[model samples]
Target: MTTGPSQQATFAGMPTPLYSGSPSRLLAWLDCPRRYRMQYLDRPRPAARAQRAHTSVGIATHNALRDFWDLPLAQRTPAGVAELVRSSWIDVGFRDPEQSAAWRLRVRDAVTDYLRRSDRERQPVGVERSVSLKTEQIAITGRVDRLDDRDGELVVVDYKTGRQVPTDDDARTSLPLALYAVASARMFRRACHRVELHHVPSGTVAVHEHTDDSLSRKVAEAESIAADLRRADAEFAQVGVESPRFEPRPSAICGWCDFRAHCPEGQRMGPEKSDWAGLEPAGYESAAAGTALP
Candidate 1:
């Protein structure tokens, strides 16, 4: 008897699946398979202004904050972090100097607020730690923002620069956080049961508690999604003609898609422009807005 394609095998034997069924990629798969095929599979070079800006700001912000956390407790001063932010800052996507200035101020404020609010009692155990786990045939990989040890237990901390605060439920359901928890626990040889989202804008922390079973379930779900994506790709390859199997799923976010001007369905959806930072307040909104259109 022959075995059908297992979930694990779908992502097996690669240097790490270049694309996992991350929440981001899942939306891409849902929005327009062609876009996913081009970006993920074909690995096309990005040429759009908005895309470059969004990616640049997020990278700059994440890196600056990570560097701050890497500083010694005595040196984790507001001035130091602000300087880091300035050095890492990138102005790729902003249309005007005023808009760019406004974002820089916002980032400065967020970093100041985070430094003041933190306890500074303990240091981060890891910053930007990349981890991977396999289930059946699928391999999932992600870089955690930060991981800290508190009272002998591991904590997964994610930094958010958006305007709104995520709820405890949002943290619990987050795939990256869950994957981080799983990988951290194994890496540290201890249990990691708490996940926190540090909302820099609101200066508040959202916390979620996870059971071992729940973490396992999240990994299983990710592996299952990876399996589905692999199957879809295979089916598309067999039929050819740009995969009719993958159709455009339009939504409120069509207006904000960077690919909107280029996508047929996106163009028909009526184009509307929005700033990357100002447009989406939450992770879900941002992810939805990133989808490719018709």
Candidate 2:
């Protein structure tokens, strides 16, 4: 006997569990199906190139920010931030030691300035907190950079170390931020409707206030993406690369594709960028941002 398309998706006795993914995973599919297949489904995944200096900077900045809250109140000073940056720095993926050291000092200052404007006296609700949001269709999990309680309302704050200073529209449209806000609210049993993108380099906070309807809409949007992923993932399991579901979507940003080394179609789009191509000063355009998968 043959099963219907829906029934074929089922295992011996029950339907498959809800799709598990992060906002990044969904975005990866939207960015390029071939990339999603490689990064998520392909066994013996292709090795991505060495990290860029800019990514190192971003990593260091995030680590320093996360560790800062753990320090004793008195040690949360600018000098302390410098110490954390030094301790958490990843020296890989740079032009040279000199370039690495220069960027290190710049990041130190950026974090220091950003923290100066923060209210150290008021402790945050959470830092680098892992939260999950689940619906009947999808189970989403991610780590939020920071969670704040302003006037008893929960806020989701995502730190951006990239060149672009995010705007209000970015905050409004961000799926990850919206999902985090929903998860934080549900986890803490508080109303969380505000999301802020804290652009660390420029110390700018782009804010957006989401309504209940808006958040619900975002979740529905996520569910839609997950449904597609569910089907593609199943197809990949059957035929792998032969799965027409995963297509190569190339663009000029091929220069920044970490998986470009494996994708002939992408390589044909443009020349690969230098390992340090994305290491420009934060004030400069984040080359990665140009083609950054939304």
Best by lDDT: 2
Question: Estimated TM-score per prediction?
Answer: 0.80, 0.91
lDDT of 2 by residue, 1-294 (tens): 223222234567675577888999999999999988888888889898888877998999999999989999888887788899999999988889998887888787778877877887778999999999989889999999999999999999999987677999999999999999999999999999999999988778999999999999999999999999988887877777898999989877678888999999999887888878776554532222212111
Per-residue lDDT for 55 in model 1?
Answer: 54
Which candidate wins on TM-score?
A: 2
Which ranges of candidate 1 are over 4 A from the true structure? 1-23, 30-32, 43-49, 52-57, 239-241, 276-294
TM-score of 2: 0.91
Alpha-carbon lDDT, every model:
0.67, 0.86
lDDT of 1 by residue, 64-114 (tens): 877886676666666676678788888876767776666665666666666
